[model samples]
Target chain A: MPDAPDAVEQAVRQVLTSINGDLTPTETMLLGELEALAQEIQRAKREISALSIGDISDSHIPVATDELDAVLAHTAEATNEILDCCEKLENTAPELPEGPAAVVNDAVTRIYEACSFQDITGQRIGKVVTALKAIEARLMRVTDRFGSVSSAPAEPQAPDTRTQGQQLANGPQLPGNASSQAEIDSLLASFD
Target chain B: MDKNTNILIVDDYKTMLRIIRNLLKQLDFNNVDEASDGSEALTKLRAGNFGLVISDWNMVPMTGLDLLKEVRADARLKNLPFIMITAESKTENVVAAKQAGVSNYIVKPFNAETLKEKIEKVMVHA
Candidate 1:
């Protein structure tokens, strides 16, 4: 066991260096190429692993988009339905105590009118959906590039048509940045 | 405000179009037409005799700002009252809309009252 380790290193050195009659120049060169090929293989493996789709963070984009879309769609639909029912109720004009009937009619119409929120919200949600779609397409390209042998479709480049100062069209800022209706009106006043 | 004045509502979303139409109806402005995007709005603006325009800001290919500019650039529609409805409350967006000759701007989630005020103001000024 004392000579075991030393003997193996000595023999390998002899094979590669050809200090002994055990190897030819061609065979030694071939061994060098094989060693290089092994290093190439390791590099290739690292690159493949780097692109593993499983490593991609669970993108909340799709989940958020789906939930937002569903909520917007449902809200819009329900609002429209209520509006229709209100219109019908207004039209029927059933015999009732005139005061209560007028109150109910006005309330119903207000509710019907309030339903317009759904349309604007639905529009905003649509913009979110479009942005999510662009993100999803990129993620799919990333997945396909490393996950599949076939060539993935090329990612479409969006044209740069943003306003000179505004690069991204950010819709409705979060609580902090979003100005209240009062602030907006004040700003308008100041402009005037 | 003339409730009988012909108005054009432009937005990419059908929902927004419907909502604007309904809101206009509530304001007693029933003579309203719809366009789904700035391009369509421009085309309709050319074809029809609309006195006012209410448009959304985030449409594709052409945005409400673009429509505003186009409307301003057009000889026939230059003075037509235009209001922009946007979720973008950024000062820059407001400034840009103002520069583009927008009659007024409405931040999103606005109610019928706000819509009426903006429309009436624009109509009066125009």
Candidate 2:
């Protein structure tokens, strides 16, 4: 009793329904891949945070010559670990997806590379810190020696008998007399 | 030098000044004076008999460099040794200080070791 045209339309509709149903397996496969990638990205981020490179570099550790080499070596080792992780991720990354998923994958890759670069940078900074510590230690020793040499008390003598040069070298003589003033002025001029 | 030998330390940071004072005390140089800025330091220098000056480069009212210039220009204090403590690590700053007749230079945040070396070097060379 159905019209011929209606019957033909129903057949076409059935075919379209079957074709859509066939895509279920493909969609499930893509979704599973996406879920795995998301989990991988999250795990990578957690690992990066656990490495704590920023905290280590920012810390105010007392630096010494002996420790400097060790610190740098440790930094390099840590960086290497991060790089290895990134290499693993790069190698295992699934075939590129289209649309927003591709964008996310690209972002994740860039982050991994950035983390690797930071590690390298941190090692270089560690070396510099070590060198600076050595310089600081040397300077402190010199300051200590000067302090001892300068602080030793000389034999006591009458103030008036002391030479003007001696008084200025000792310190500014109190009671700003013309003689002391003249002596200090003359000494200051020599620097010019 | 005895307990009477007056030394002046100038810096903007109170903590730094205290550290220097404590270090000076350890070396048996008990007669140490402190000023918080270049102007204050200059005032103290003029008011008291100071043997040596240790100053920070970056300070308000006057810089360590300016204070050095003033000390050098003054007839009475011309021979006074001036050491500059700075955070700047540039070669140019060091060269400039040497040219200005600075007795020595030390970069910060320095430990006690670097401080000692520079002081000895300046005392001997200057």
- What is the interface root-mean-square deviation of candidate 2? 19.6
Off by over 4 Å in 1: A1-72, A90-109, A112-159, A163-168
Q: Ten consecutive residues with minimal summed lDDT in candidate 1 chain A?
A: A1-10
Best by DockQ: 1
TM-score of chain B of 1: 0.97
Q: Pick the TM-score winner.
A: 1
lDDT of each: 0.75, 0.58
List per-model TM-scores for chain B.
0.97, 0.90
The clash tally of candidate 1 reads 0
lDDT of 2 at A76: 55
Taking every candidate in turn, the Cα RMSD to the unseen true structure, in Å, is 8.9, 31.6
Please report, as a residue range, the 10-residue window in candidate 2 chain B with the lowest summed lDDT.
Answer: B87-96
Structure candidate 1, residue pairs in collision? none
Worst 10 residues of 2 chain A by lDDT: A164-173
